[model samples]
Target: MESDEIVRKFYDETVDDEWERLERHRVEFELTKRYLNRYIKPGDKVLDLGGGPGRYSLYLAELGCDVTLADLSEKNIEFALKKANEQGLAIKRLQVDARELSTIEDSQFDYVLCMGPMYHLKSEEDRAKTIRECLKKLKPNGIMFVAFISSYSFVWDYLIRNPELILDSERKSELNKIVDGKDFAGKGFSDNFYISPENVLPFFNQFDLEKLHLLNSESFLYLREPELLRQKPEVINAWLDLAEQVCEREDLLSMAEHIMYIGKKPIKT
Candidate 1:
């Protein structure tokens, strides 16, 4: 219940901030959308499990997909509904936990977006349970997009946000603890689980799913200060094209902040 409380309290307090995260992080949003569009069709039924404020759900609905947004925070659901109404997009909402999606019928959704839950599931059992629940709701051969915060995200974050602490030898041990998915001492989101870059694909391979993709959401454009690139339309387009070209490159996967795994549930033989 502590994990649940952490997720609800954090997301509830930052509903508007969460909504703008995608808008501000242009590459993360655009590249993720590109990957989603590649597999999902116009009329697909999409379940955005743990979707905060329904950003993706609203986007999918606008593209003619039937979407249901679910999250642990009642506030997120309310905010998502409000946004959906303002956008004139009709998307269903549910206040549900990712590990327990029993209210949703099994094997109905064409796509399952289990993006946010994995980020906070600190235990292996909770992660696997949530994955099973997502798979249970997914139709055979359905596409599932799961997102992960890279184990080393804090390394980059520290260098950017806390430059002064780098020289502190004491900070090295702190970062090491964070790499193993523990909470950082003083900042950022709490109770988040970080995945090692090398283990991203292999972790999901244990399941009965075909690996479609394992790539960084921001790709090579991450620390390059993408916000500056956004000012030039042509440059942003070309950079996005380059990112999509190399996003799935295996060698470059570890340098990203957010990693996404695209998998397809295999139909029973």
Candidate 2:
């Protein structure tokens, strides 16, 4: 797989709409927050890498966690800062790539959120570099939330949104490529790729961290945000409760559009 240099430009162009993503797909944000609340205490230092437009970073900041938000897109960093100020939240900001965060020292943060980098990192070497760098920034026993846009989720997206493309010979061939472990031709999201659910946990095993949870972020709720918004709060809460109950089920991992792999760094021997 190869990378296209569209990450910064694509995110920069869409920075304004970034926060609205959470607004639309409320489950991803809510579940991730629930996990964060369990682990992140007040004054805990956090690194929100590829944390576009300050959604998670701002949430952490508002919780009194010292959040340092970083991203490859300058426009995203600027937007995140502007919103943080609007929310009266204090967030340290940096415009940097996940693969090379040299300015951030090793073992500095209690929590690290590598939220968006995996979606665009095509080369396996780059993916390894990014995770290695991010984990190195985490304090011993600190938590990390590494997210990905699931490859199986993308297949659902095609079935739900663009069914016609699924049957077309040329498009079918391309989709097959992705199913067979290749990157997608970035559609609405420019230069995107997906990782299989089966690969996620094992991918992190190579790191010096104890595996904790692999959450299927929007289980069976993939591309159903519009319907979710129409539900009563109690109804939505009920479904969310069920989602939480079943999120860790390996069978349901691919049903989610987004998934987060949580792990804790080991205390040095």
Candidate 3:
């Protein structure tokens, strides 16, 4: 399905403008930043693999982390550079595919953030390669963060918001495949794949990584559109707190639109 080209076109065309506008996306950014803050210290080296438009890269750099942002789209990389310059931050920007990071040295970064690549690599092998590349760049005992789209959330969204789109038998079949941890590459919906907690956890277990946390990036909060738009500041804070409290419940993780896996490389014995 030429998934690489599809991913390139999708991000190059819309990622910069589309994500920041959503309330869900705002929550994702804030939560991710908060989580990263707990692990990153001043002068630490961070590799932001597949970081779209350097949003996190710039934030990390501002916090005194030496950051390098790598993305598949040249357009994204260029935009990130301009953004870094405007903020008076120094960040290394590179255009490279996640599956192949030969230019990056092994065990070089104190932390690796693969925030956007896992969902786009449609095949299991490619997804594994991307993970290995990210781990290869992490120093022993360094932390890594990976994000994925949730199949349960995708199915729930269709049932609640877009049932009409899946009324067709073919579309319904594709949805079933997605639930089974398979992606429909030529479906023309979005190019990215989806994963369930069952499939994701086992995949990471194959690596020499110590599990830290599996969090729902945007939990039930994303489903509550009316409350998100109309609630008072205090109410919103309470909702966010609730979301964080339940983000790690395995029974509820699949309900999140996006899931995050935080792990660390084991130090060599």
TM-score of each: 0.93, 0.93, 0.90
Instruction: Quantify all predictions' global Cα lDDT against the true fold.
Output: 0.85, 0.83, 0.82
Give the per-residue lDDT of model 3 (tens digit) for 1-269: 47788888877897667436444456677677778988999899999999988888989999999999999988888888898899999999888999999999999999999988876777888999999999899999999999987776657678767888687887687677654664333343457677766777888978999999999887666676455748787876777777777778887876787889999999998
* lDDT of candidate model 3 versus the reference: 0.82
Candidate achieving higher TM-score, 1 or 3: 1
Task: Spell out the clash pairs found in candidate 1.
Answer: none
Tens-digit lDDT string for candidate 2 (142-181):
8889998887665776787788887788657756865576
TM-score computed on alpha carbons, candidate 3: 0.90
**lDDT against true structure, model 1:** 0.85
Candidate 1 C-alpha lDDT tens digits along 120-217:
88787888899899999999989899998887787878887787776787777657764475433233476787777887766786788898888989
Q: Which scores greater on lDDT, model 1 or model 3?
A: 1
After best superposition, candidate 3 residue 229: deviation in angstroms? 4.3
Clash total of candidate 2: 0
Error of 3 at 269 (Å): 1.4
